[model samples]
Target: MSIIAFSIAKIYSDSALNDENTFEETEKKFDKINNNDGIFEYKSDGFYLKQNKTREYIKWIEIESVIYFDYHILKNVNSTGIEISTSHKIYKIHNNDERSMGIEKFENELNKNINKNELYDSEVLSDGSSKTPLYIKSKI
Candidate 1:
């Protein structure tokens, strides 16, 4: 009876340990999918863009305008690109970049964070290019 009780207790303890490990692994996977993108990471406050050697962090409030354009590579092959103008600098993301498949998703997320008053879509030009003016703060 003593041996049987000890075996049952050991089995139960091992099962509990395995369950904990499984839960931890599942959580890690969820976090990876949630926070990571091809070339960006979406956060509660802002997003991070990973380039060749530098990682740029832009806050939602700093973005001034967003320009969406289609890059015509060939007669049939066209790619999408976005130019993000912020108070500090301008950043461009094209579909040709490595791990940049999340550009559209990033753009959508950005739209959700920016204020409607400040968010300006690009104006199309005669040559098919686009532009947007720098964000001017409202004087009240």
Candidate 2:
């Protein structure tokens, strides 16, 4: 059984930005336990259930602030994969199609605050590639 606690839930409510929305609803939190036989045991708030018995796709009742782990995020980015670095640790955002929009939204927020011109020189990288960093706009 693997347990992961995320700061927020990435919900896919739109398709224009690739069908995703990151909502900061903090009411439901739970753990997903997976058995060896490909059965998933979801435990949270006095709810215990099993999935993946008959079919590969399993659906559950929607909760206020719970998001499932999507593995497709890591697959579509590149062969080397997408590596996200935070202040605490490095995370490999895997490929889970549902979560793609949320991740991209978060990245956009971070990129907006970065000042590429001030941080790095105008020279290209060792691979002869130069990409400008993202700059975020402030509200105030």
Candidate 3:
């Protein structure tokens, strides 16, 4: 059973879980990482997304990739995040939209314990994609 915790209620099955709009809102709302109100201790068994607060598990196999990134345009609300893309939804976790030094910490936490060979190492995936030690698409 796949469960997504949008709140204390609103749990959906994995088969019924890909509503783009809802996921987008969930992403945008939870973009920043604040200890009092954000995701932490993220881990996977190569198949699920486990973290705090929600206690909902997103299967990783359902995810196409996790694009961890940080960018700013004219310092307009500095945005830094990991875009979790699945076959039908995108979940954004903006690590530090309010600050400048937290992106690195967010990233380090994101890649913690995951092997280097398990994710997309290059900034861009070439026309010829390289295979990861683990068959999952995660780029940093």
- Tell me the tens digit of each residue's lDDT in model 1 across 23-44: 5566876665544467877788
Ordering by lDDT? 1, 3, 2
Query: Judged by lDDT, which candidate is best?
Result: 1
With candidate 1 superimposed using the best TM-score fit, by how many Å does residue 136's alpha carbon deviate from the native?
9.3
Candidate 3 per-residue lDDT, tens place, 20-85, comes to 546555665455433222343344543233333344455545656566554543435444456666
lDDT of 2 by residue, 42-80 (tens): 233222222222312212222111211222224353211
Which residue pairs come into collision in candidate 3?
31-94, 47-60
Which is the better candidate, 1 or 2, if ranked by lDDT? 1
lDDT of each: 0.68, 0.28, 0.47
Candidate 3 wrongly placed segments (more than 4 Å): 1-56, 97-140
Candidate 1 at 100: error in angstroms? 1.6
TM-score of 3: 0.37
Off by over 4 Å in 1: 1-36, 73-79, 117-122, 128-140
RMSD of 1: 12.2
